[model samples]
Target: MSIFERMKQGATEAARKVEQTVEISKLKSQISTREKEIDRLYARTGKAVYDAYSRGDLSRSETEVMDYCEQLSDLHEDIKLIQEKITNIKLEKSCSACGKIVPVNARFCPDCGKKFPEDDEKPQESTVGEIRVLCAVCGTENDIGARYCVECGNELSPAAGDRSKPNDPAGDSIV
Candidate 1:
């Protein structure tokens, strides 16, 4: 090929690459936006379900509740994929003791208590536990696992040591 033809071909190839890169960036931005939208939709759906349940309305006419349940399975799969992507994208920060992934500047790992660089903090997973507690003073609902109310800041009833149980013949203790 002539020198001029080679130059033209190189320019065209570079332009195509630039276009491709732009397209990829656009797609990434769109994905991020859609992810936010999905999150908002999930929150709204959860609220609707809660509201309907409070009203004792279990009818299937609620689109938000139905959509949420329908999306739950797909969302779970998407969550795993997102986690994998995050694990891949984040900078590697290994714990010196256990050789596990740690924050870039972690002061101490609850797992090993080994000081690691704690740079970025990711949201932790939520686990399910059943416990019921009613605040004594404010009569506010408190988490069974919580030591204090998040709203009223009232100290929760400490786990009784059966002191209250021994006094009564009935097995019921102060909860």
Candidate 2:
């Protein structure tokens, strides 16, 4: 092939890969959203079922509860499949200790500090975003949106500029 032709082909291939990566990221985000929805449905269904039973109301069957459970199960399965695809695309592996995904060539798992077995795959760019917030107390990295530290249960304040300190009228005075 001519040099120009080869260059054009490479550029097209690169663009295709970028589009694929974006699609995968989108799928991962959707999976996260779906999982949250399943949690909400679980809580709602539980309350509905409990309220019905506590009131001696047998009019409502298990249909709603069954549906919620089925949906949750399906969402979990879909998440697994999407995770598999992400792992395949990123050439990553799940940490044995914590189940957190890490690059295949990593020597130590970032989440759990578990050492990884030596592998042949060279390290590629991490697919995970650098959006996690570090816990001030325990130092465990939590989601940027997490309101509480997952490891130590400490209440997290909003990021800088997002939270305002309590106003002190006296402290603000000339004293």
Candidate 3:
């Protein structure tokens, strides 16, 4: 190729790289804004739930709580996708256990003792609409799909439905 053609090609490649960088930056900013919104939604939902409980009106808050939870879940998934894009752009990897950024070639996370999954292994997708179950016996939170409490080894079935109220029938609130 001639010198002038080589110069033009180089300039075109540099312009494309700058354009790609700006797009990634925009995505990052959007993720940050979405995260802040999620935080605000969480606080608002918590207050709504609290206000309902204080008034002995748990049923009234259920719909709003569900909506907030769904929104938060969607935001989390979007953040994950954005992070994946950033990772691809930077050629980085994330620790599955702690979600910390790490080198793509690293075998384990430096911040957490999480081993990277092998190339042939695939991670499991999380179950959608998983409602967290608070253990009535020990006040420990467990997965919605968990059969037993991880903290106190208590059965989760009986305590699952009692999330909005006290476990004791005679009590008005959770102690």
- Which one wins on lDDT? 3
Q: What would the per-residue lDDT of candidate 2 be over residues 51-133, giving only the tens digit for each residue?
A: 78998884583777888888888988888898777777767788777886655655555544566666634656433446776
User: Native-vs-model 1 lDDT?
Assistant: 0.54
Estimate every model's Cα lDDT from 0 to 1: 0.54, 0.68, 0.70
Q: Per-residue CA lDDT of candidate 1, range 36-145, in tens?
A: 76787688787887777888884743876777767765655675565444443442345567655643333443234454443444443222254545567666444444
1 against 2, candidate with superior TM-score: 2
- Candidate 1: pairs in clash: 104-117, 104-118, 104-119, 105-117, 105-118, 105-119, 106-116, 106-117, 106-118
TM-score of 3: 0.49
C-alpha TM-scores of all predictions: 0.34, 0.45, 0.49
Per-residue lDDT tens digits of candidate 3, residues 14-37? 786798799899999989999999
Of the two candidates 1 and 3, the one with more favorable TM-score, higher being better, is: 3
Winner by TM-score: 3
Clashing residue pairs in candidate 3 are: none
Tally clashes: model 1: 9
Would you list the clashing residue pairs of candidate 2? none
| RMSD versus native structure for model 3 | 21.6
